[model samples]
Target: MSSSLAQKLETRAKSLGFDVVRFTNANLPELTGARLQAFVEAEWHGDMAWMPETLTRRKTPTAMWDGAVSAIVLATNYGPEVDPLERLTNKTTGNISVYALNRDYHDVVKGKLKQLAGWFASQSGQEVKV
Candidate 1:
């Protein structure tokens, strides 16, 4: 990706509430696949059965989609602005986790992702799989 395009994507992602945006080659390392296998074999994911089911595809982006050349990862902080530990001792009022108190982030994020994907396709003149 061009530096200018990367900057634009980063800026747009930030405007859409993404705290962190990064771009990486789609082909993941062998170590990643090995680690994922280890994680699944150890049964550390608990009730998330999808993790093991999708293990083969999750090992690498290319395994899931052959045409994918790059990956844009976005992350946001869902933690509360105030100290959550302080609320542990306060039994008078109910304390809710910051993420749980707000509207479902999935909806918000999906909308933003669509917007971002549209913008990216327009800018890069490339098809966005998502």
Candidate 2:
């Protein structure tokens, strides 16, 4: 198979602070798409109405937005000073999402992304938006 867009983006994305990078074709392969279809057909989404409503978009991100040439999914260290995973085992209290252990990542990550995208925009003339 040909190298994926992620692979092509990896070299530059790594320079942008990604320690690890991988690429899959934006187009879903039949086998994987069939698996996703099976999951939906089996009613696994339950109360997640949006999951069903956006099934096609989730399966193919291009449907979510036009001219969606790339998906730069960034993973970062949102953990606390300690091994936060330990807290989840207690079950004595409510279980929090691992990523939500700290401040709301949406605000933090989006702010940081805007900053970086701002810098990129300064360098290039593209208008940046989420």
- For all candidates in order, the CA lDDT equals 0.88, 0.64
lDDT by residue for model 1 (23-124), tens: 888988899899999999999999999999999889987878888888999998766677888988988998787678777888877888999999999999
Using all chains and alpha carbons, the TM-scores for the candidates as numbered come to 0.86, 0.54
Off by over 4 Å in 1: none
TM-score winner among the candidates?
A: 1
Compute the lDDT for candidate 2.
0.64
Model 1 earns a TM-score of 0.86
Query: Quick one: best lDDT, which candidate?
Result: 1
Q: State the number of backbone clashes in model 2.
A: 0
